[model samples]
Target: MGAYISTFPTGFAGLIPTALQKLLPGAQVVQVYDGLVHYRYGGKPGDLGKVFLFHNTFLVLREFQGPASQMDSMVRSAAGIKSLPPSRGSFRVRYSVKNQFVAVPKERTRQLEGKIAALTHAKVDRVSPDTEYWFLQRSEGVGFFCRLLGRRQATERDLHPGELRPELAYLMASLAKLGRDSVVLDPFAGYGAIPKQVLGYFPYAMVLVSDLDRDRAVDLRASLGGKRGVSVAQRDALTLEGIPGATVDAIITDPPWGYYEEIEDIQVFYRGMFASFRRVLKPRGQVVLLSARKREAEAAAQEMGFPLRQRYDTLVNGKKAAVYLLEVGPAL
Candidate 1:
């Protein structure tokens, strides 16, 4: 089986391996470069989006030299200038230039595009929503990949600003290991993106979503609720009323990012959230949270006794952020 190349957001490279380990266990995962992973399963892994923000996955036909020799390698690897096909679709060629292929001239880039067109026997349509091909300039060489899945819609969904992205949401859910019959909660379920993605990825898990914004909560409660096993309500994260202590299997939440909620004391806000999560989560249960503000979140987590179990450096809206998985307490 030819390896499939999965691409992710720049800083989210850490999530690729973790998600693949869980979903495609026993499959070989090679981090060929930053933001890229090469893996091959025995059989087709249906719906790769269930794992996380996989920008796209493609079948690698060949790997060879970058820049000066990239075009030659691609042309030859794809069979040295194939004859034109009568009804061939367009191709979106992605040229990834880094250290190896730096200082290239504009003429070289244009030449590479021409080479790609020749290989596909089709036009290089950057605008057309068509078959895609990726070229990465690596230290070893420039790897060429033919797009198999043109569009990976797992992370592309209706979401509000400041709401958690579906890609990140899936990652958070996967970290919790939530599955069939599990009672999972998203305390600050803004616009319900968290629950929506969770349901889409792990349909069997029982999701309890709560949001403070009454209007958004109502809409999400109507739309994001009533899936295979989903419930939604308007509730405050600081006070998870009617929820008993130590009952929740996991709490995966994206708390207010300070800018959207206009929080005066973000530290105090974070501390309250941690305390609430600590109350509802069962012993050894996990709390996965993402925030752009690092210092405040780190301080509050430490003070509230939620030590970090896993951390992924991330980017949100072009700002630095991180995903934290915190353990409840000492394991039984």
Candidate 2:
């Protein structure tokens, strides 16, 4: 059976299996090695699982762990030989190790490689092998598993100040139901974390990134670079009158919550955001919002003629955070 491999965030590995089910319907989840899950299926899947070739696998390992010591060890293991040339039919091992823990031992790898070679009578070269014997190491533990092809690395970028974490970005992207062509707009695009993440998955889609502070907007633009087709603007998110009407597909943002300033008019700001969102987003388009004030956000959406579609519980710095998905009202 044609097989493939996938990787996900450390604690969020559970989401990968769910995503794979959606991407490759009826595909058997033959093996799950810690963070890497192996699937036996036919055709290639979509971007939901960062699919990768041999070269891409090498790049991902180098980027994630640097130097690829684990990969080298796997090459010398006897099991490596049994998985010769790394094809879909070959058996391979995949796992994750703690980033700070003891580095993988070369002797252990050599013994594994020798065993595989003896069993299969094949030479092992882990670097360019097609069989994806992958390793993932986080702060907690190591995971090992294998499949026919290695998947791509999860999205990685320089996070902006006051931006949500990478894990949150992944969750937001998935929760937003973003398609390959879905246009994403981030009004309070502080440092452009959400937009950058959206672009990472949907590079060709339109992204409207805006922030009130001009300097922050400039920084966001610089971080985003000029390569991706992104449009940057400096404007007040609360009053999005400057933005064109009926121009957005989905609104996904982490708006400012009154924490330090204890602003008296917090409700007004939320109402404005809701009104602007209703004005710009398409009828079927939705808004996925991350907010500290769940009740306030829900109330604003209701007042603005929007309906709450879904809500997800998230954590920020060990504190409770809520993610809301809303759809525009019929009158809008």
lDDT per prediction? 0.71, 0.61
Give the lDDT of residue 218 in candidate 1: 89
Give Cα distance to truth, residue 29, candidate 1, Å.
3.6
- Model 2 lDDT tens row, 136-225: 544323233333233344323444346676556656766777766767788888867678667765433677888888898898778774
lDDT of 1 at 295: 91
Instruction: List the lowest-lDDT window of 10 residues for candidate 1.
Output: 78-87
Q: What lDDT would candidate 1 get against the real structure?
A: 0.71
Candidate 1 RMSD to the correct structure: 4.5
Which stretches of model 1 miss by more than 4 angstroms? 10-33, 41-52, 65-87, 90-94, 99-120, 124-133, 139-142, 145-158, 179-181, 203-205, 330-332
- Give me the displacement of residue 275 in model 1, in angstroms: 1.7
Measured against the true structure, the TM-scores of the candidates, in listed sequence, are 0.78, 0.57
Where is the poorest 10-residue window by lDDT in model 2?
A: 53-62
